[model samples]
Target: MRLIIAGLFALAVMLSPAAYAVQPDEIMADPVKEARARDLSRELRCMVCQNQSIDDSEAPLARDLRLLVRERIAAGDSDSQVIDFLVARYGEFVLLKPRFERQTWLLWLLTPLALAGGGLALWMHGRRRPKSAPGEDGSEAILSAAEEARLQRLMAAEPPPESPS
Candidate 1:
């Protein structure tokens, strides 16, 4: 009976809606404003949980940010205006997806630049490698004629191994 109750409890927990950091009091009365606030919250980064958005973080800073967004919406601030305010107050680090601007140009451009540089390096490496010579049997020869001759001479000079008793 205990095992069955435990199994049912586990199943109930699994079926429950995903928990969010937003508390009931933080939600705005107006549906449209609430939606806008939620959207903005998802875009804003949690200062305490650097990788998580304020909407998904339970930290005190995240809660404060969530309330600030709702407060801005209630005061009739446009979405862009709220974002600009946050950016001004906390800098670009407050945004989960940073704006493409002069200061962040290198952050946005580095990946493509690195990929292009790597491709150029690979192409140059391939060009510098010697082309293989085709053998009489239509197979590529891995060793030069001088190296092959030296290998043959070395093999001839080595004694034959005795058969196992």
Candidate 2:
């Protein structure tokens, strides 16, 4: 149906990953510089929109960051230089991907450390609990001497079970 086709088209548009928040006035005149600026925008996190990059955020802070990146690029700063400037202005938290320096080594190493800890815990748990033997019931009837004597007396008091052959 036409309605079904329209709905599918709308859903497809929504599901696509091509969303960008860059405005027309923000684009640089030079193509190469614009490309570099765009790439830098992708690398920088928008402070106002915590999880989104400046290139994909509509926040006023994101717009200012985009302009700032373009200005730095125009001023003949290299990608690394621009990034360093941003880092110096705002702490290392501004970068979407953090450098693996001494200060950030713990952040990089934590996942593997946690995984190893989990694996060790699983191994220790496995060692502590032995597997039950196949075809063997673990439960056993444990009776004390008094209990055994009482059981014997009760058995003697009961009539023999009639067997049907």
State the C-alpha lDDT per candidate: 0.90, 0.90
Screening candidate 2 with a backbone cut-off below 3 angstroms (N, C-alpha, C), the clashing residue pairs are: none
Of candidate 2, the 10-residue stretch with the lowest lDDT total is 13-22
**Alpha-carbon runs more than 4 Å astray in model 2:** 1-20, 134-165
Output the lDDT of residue 138, model 2: 59
Kindly report which residue pairs in candidate 1 clash with one another: none
What does candidate 2's lDDT look like per residue over 9-122, in tens digits?
A: 988876653344787888899999999999999999999888888888888888899999999999999999999999999889999999999999999999999999999999
Q: What is the lDDT of residue 109 in candidate 2?
A: 99
lDDT, candidate 2, equals 0.90
| Model 1, residue 87: C-alpha shift (Å) | 0.7
Backbone clashes, each candidate = 0, 0
